[model samples]
Target: MIAGDPAATGRPGLLGSVWPFWVLFSAIYLMLRWPFVATGRFIDPDDELRLVQMRDLLAGQSWFDLHQYRIDPPGGVVMHWSRLVDAPLAAVQLLLRPLLGPALAEQIATVIVPLGTFAVILFLLSRLAARLVDRDLAGYCAVIAGVSFPLASQVLPTRIDHHGWQIAAALAALLGLVDRAPRRGGALAGLSIAVGMAISLELLPIAALFGAVLLLQALRGAEGRERIGAFLLAVWAGSVTAFALTRGTDLTNYCDAVSPVYLAAMTIVCAAGSSTAVFPRLTMPAYLLILAASGGLALAAIAAINPQCLAGPFSSLDPLLGTLWYDRVAEGRPLFTMNGVLVTQWLVPPLMGLGAALVLWRRASGADRALWLDYALVLAGTVLLGVVVTRSMALAAAFAAVPVAWLVRDAAQNLPKRRGIGQWAMSLAVPVLAIMPALPAQFALTGVEALSAAPAKATAGAQPRAGNAPLQAQDLAAIGNLPRATIFATFDIGPTLLRTTHHSVVATGHHRGAVPMRDVMVAFIADPAAARHIVVRHKARYVILAPDLPEISNYREFAPRGLAVRLADGEIPDWLVPVPSATTARVKTFAVRY
Candidate 1:
């Protein structure tokens, strides 16, 4: 580093150390995310709902009541989300609302909260990258984190969902894995997983993988035993506290979220694991016996608390819903099942990262080799997990960032010594492809297709997407003027409808609303009379069809004579009276004439 480099010394204060990352990340992210910030648009339905969740919390909804009362009316669906996620968002909104007024405050909250999360992720990754390679590459790590689509997408502006938090927790776990202090590292890994699990049980698999890695280390010696023991104790302690504070008096053991059942299971693991550290350094065989018995004991406790959970959350999902809705969620599906181009884009960064990990492991020696080997195994396992569950790829991408950065640095530093132009080009291409695997390929393919389709494009007139913007905007304005009432709508429209107006929706794409979602899906695919009966059953006063009505195309196809198709064709049933149009609002709103 140069003598006067502020970032290199990190001398000013806490923020000074990470200010370079913050400024770099913000500059890159804001330019890229300017469109969403300008329009106050949310990237995902989940983010819209997260805003609703934050609003409710700030509006004085009980902390323990995780119900979206607007979702199913009288008997609302109980959300599996924890209050921990809602806290920071509410705080931000509360802080800004008085100054900017309610509307502007909300828009700012969405942007600020996620951008804050983005900065944290970069700082953590840069520190990890610095340890793995060089402190000089910390800025490079920040740049890559902001520019990398997989990592950036999770925490970009208006992305208030918990996915970013989960990624941060996973990085914390990775740091814990490599930390020198056995107890602190284990505690960091354990508590971070606990927090992640409290937010979403998606972390369950990560917790298991981490637990296994820690357990394997325990077999080596006493330092290893302390690490494993601290992990179990910390997880057990952390999960218990989170459950009590968040769940309150709600005692019904839920399979979908962390409940007493999980805490009980943790108790068994903690007690057994802690014993290994208390006693004299035991034989590997002794540790094996204890671990085996602990698993059995935990399973037995789970059976006592809620045996049904053993089958997992999706076990009880209605078969029809699974076929129509759950099966079609692209992000939730395996990598191979996704579009080839999309799969390649997501696979490249992490695969390159794993390759780097293998290189780092091979080149290292002594304890460093063992550390890199551990990193390699975890990275490889996470990559495999991402292959099976595609959204997990984001976490894998974040994990891969350090090694990928290190690899890029190694290549760049060796560039001056290279003999050929071909070598120079290859070295240059490594970082480009590493950061954006799909863009070049996508651009090339798009260019080829554009040339081939030029005549068709010239004849077809225009695309609907640009046209959709104003129609959706005007519909939101119109709906916002109406009286608050429950509206029966398609799955994708539910979240935004709730956000933009003082309206309630029967259901959204959220799985916790499974029962109501089932009824809604059935109505969409049923005969007009049947659909009317279902709509009236929910006590909904209106039905909204999004501009494209693209969300329920499955309903239109599965039942050709279904309500979704009838509505799309302007074949309104007698029971539905057309709401007055402010403009040619393609997202049709129908008032139920019950």
Candidate 2:
């Protein structure tokens, strides 16, 4: 019998109920995160920006208007982010606004949205782990998913962004793969894939992977045919629905987002795939021919819509911005390019899960073997994709939970049953294991440092520098009451100021604002005289920088006479007047003397 089967024996036990599991999981999550929850600090700029988007939506920004009006002025950035993520955050804030006031309402929204996402994940993973593992171990799967460091990091109370939602969508897709009803399973997986890709194009590869898997199954028989056709239809319908709802009427077909090109591509591919699935008995040669033709047609359609997007999302980014900003984005970069100390933490847990899945698949028989085979394949894809895109590790971590839970179960069984001081010491390891999906990741860092013969710049669990936190301080709040005008500052500071203060900014780290991003970098590192012209050209009324920001330090080191460096050294330019009242010792603020 499969794990957590309701009808496996005479009756299912206490762990059979999903509600009890969710409650215990939530209790554990809340207790572990109480301190961070109390502080309510967002560790990433995206979280702050997400809150800003929610505020804009609640403040009656047009449903169609995804632009950040405070970013880059008159023609502000038309954010590529979909409105689906912002909707719930806005809804929660609206419901509580009258009762708690706006500030408290937003605070409550931040806490609720992420936790709600966890609940969805809990529901899906419990069922999925039960089907794949032992029926009794399903709750363990949900618990592990909740506590897994890589996965939990995205859903913690203050992490109110689309990332946690994306992980949940990925988990739902995995669950659909193992469902008993083929048509229902395929439809669920397809819709989840569409939702994820709508939220972020980073999910496109996984969508394609699902299509391939379903099509491969199609070669088997009528059931496979039904599955693939249902998946294709669902994806096409769901993608169109999501696009209309999220994109509204703006069909400008931007290459960065899910534009008309992607729609057209998906349509062509789904049509071809569904057509090939019509026949009752398909030969191997016919299946290969159909797959190749369908893929080719889809590629041709994309090229017809916008050939540049064929290169990828960042293809249109300015070369200067690519070097100065986009390439330096730590999370978006490849796993190997990141800090060596972190490579182990990013890779080990997922790899361990994959290993566990392989071992189980080898030992299983018949139907169980087939289930494990599917699980292993999906885990392999997610783990590889996560390595290529570091931010995607959460997807891998989510899928890995089932196998990791099984591993945890096996470990617990081996724990010393007889009680003694030494046995108690051995028992302590289980709780430590529950805390982080991969506890040895810490030791792995020591291994990396020792092997490299040089310590990495930072440790695996290193916290952000306190002095670098310009967003959390009263210094930025001091400028909150100022007139709504552009603040010409480094990309890192732009989101902070936009979220904390009522002001616009020249550029943010988002790649879509490439032109303004280039302008900001050029203005910072150019000679003071040249810099002022660039700032004035953009109609910037103020210049600002955090002296210790990595970007500001880069400017100071690369060009000693640059405006940013000059400002850092307290060598105030003649055309600039300091805004001392709104400035801090770390953050320099100035009024442009145009």
Candidate 3:
């Protein structure tokens, strides 16, 4: 038996025994994450954008209003985000500001809030691991989670995007699903799913999977019925509560954010769940009939209310916007299409975890079978999601830690008992390889380096200087120093410009900001006369270009004879006057000559 197995050793409750371990793991995580926090190196544009939103909130933007006024002027873009995330960030900053001063307070809040969120995720993962395996194995799982590259990347200090919170909410729901108690567990799961959906529709896939699991469990027996019924009630109530707390007063818009469509669907689901619980004696075939009827009715109701949403939120997006902006986001790409380094970074750990899960499933018996099945479901769902979009890799890595921990613990116990150098090597290698991507990453790096070495060497000198490159704070700061005016910039660079500079940007990476994003794209790829008209129409005072940006390549490809291509080829347009910069020459600025 495993060392901490409750069946064999009569251990206490999982939560009661795991508090100290959580503290230790949290401390270790803080230490691990401190460097990134201290250096203030936010990896994603989303993180910077989050800071921008938080700063705006602190500057006294209405709690219900999530518009970024700087982006589209007086009207602004309605950011499809909940104010729930901003509350904690603002509270922390306000609390710390008097003691640390404004800048320091903001920095501390940036580092601490995400780390705190990460700790909660670690605790939840540990709890799930303990239930799936044993207490000792759970500690190992926490360690694996602590070191998970994809998970860490999102939760690192200075990274304050909704993704980390969404992952936490998903894990919370997963934990609730595995909870033994019927009503309480179901409610918890329902509430978590509701909170996740309230945050963003990104959680829809996993949320739907969890709902299916609950419904299936309900169909199985009496206890399942009670759980599912409670879940449905909580989902309906929780979604309504979440929407009330987070959404703006504009209740009519069903296209983005939680609206009447979701409320109606949840209401129907609640009715179906309640019927199952109230009539537990119903036959399987009868129950199936009732469920199908209720679900179909719910779909029909939602379709009647908002047929546009039946196709999904982005259904109304222009084809050009999809082609030029949405499709190009790196996170949305498939794992197979990604470079070897990314593929290894994402797939290896999850694959290891999947292998371990399969091993455990074969050996599991009695009550443990149910627990392992839950783990398998989460692992499978997240792995499938990761295959579709690399962003889901973080979630897959997080869920994978449990089984990976089991593999490591099993190897440590059985292999080391043997008496030879080979035994030592195998045992040491197994745990190390299971925990870290270092070994597989080396193999991936070697091939990738070989394939791209010549190109890298050729472009090394032509590449922008370190300080002036897009995403560099210093470069954006230099742009900010110029008179505060609406700047027309590439889609990729817009977020950083908005976050770092005082000037309003014509476009950013957000899909909701598609109007200006489309305008900017057209301006870049259109004729000089057409581009000038767009710039003037948007009242944009400055045009900024970060040479060799990926968007520029797209622009050149789409319109070979356009102004952007001419600029790229060193042919300056007569109507645009180049502005000299003392800071860095890599970023070129042009003022429209009216």
lDDT of each: 0.81, 0.78, 0.77
Cα lDDT, model 1, residue 300:
95
How much does candidate 3 score in TM-score? 0.91
- Candidate 2 global lDDT: 0.78
Q: Which residue pairs in candidate 1 have backbone atoms (N, alpha carbon, C) closer than 3 angstroms, thus clashing?
A: none
- Stretches of candidate 1 off by over 4 Å are 1-18, 454-471, 582-584
* Poorest stretch of ten by lDDT in candidate 1: 1-10
Which segments of candidate 3 are over 4 A away from where they belong?
Answer: 1-41, 419-426, 444-470
* Residue 465 C-alpha lDDT in model 1: 51
> Please, what are the lDDT tens digits per residue for candidate 3 over residues 1-594?
422253422456554444665566556666776765665556677877888898998888888888888887767887888777777788999999999997888888887788778777877876677656666665677677766778877777777888888889888887778777788778888899889888888878887788777777776678877887888888888889988887746677566667878788778878886767787688888877887888898889878999888888889888888887778787887778877666766788898898787777778775566556666777888898899988888888887887888888778778848789988887887677765656667776788778877754565457543432345556766787898888887766777778767888887878788788788888888998888889888888888877667777787778888878887677787777877761345577887777
- Candidate 1 displacement at residue 162 in angstroms: 0.4
Clashes of each: 0, 5, 0
Candidate 2, pairs of clashing residues: 3-134, 3-135, 4-134, 4-135, 4-136
A best-first ranking of the candidates according to their TM-score comes to: 1, 3, 2
lDDT of 2 by residue, 1-594 (tens): 333352432245534545676676667666766765665556678888888887888888987898988889988998878898998888998899999999888887888888888888876776676666655666777777766767887877778878888988888887777665678888898889889988988788888777766766676567777777778878888889999998878888788778898889878777866776677577768866876887788889888878998999888788777776777777778888966546766577678789888988998786567667777888898888878888888888888887877877776776757477777665555445544524476577678768888556778997665455545457677677567788898887888888878899999988777788888989888888888889998898889888777887667666778888889889988989998787875677899998
As for TM-score, the candidate ahead, 2 or 3, is 3
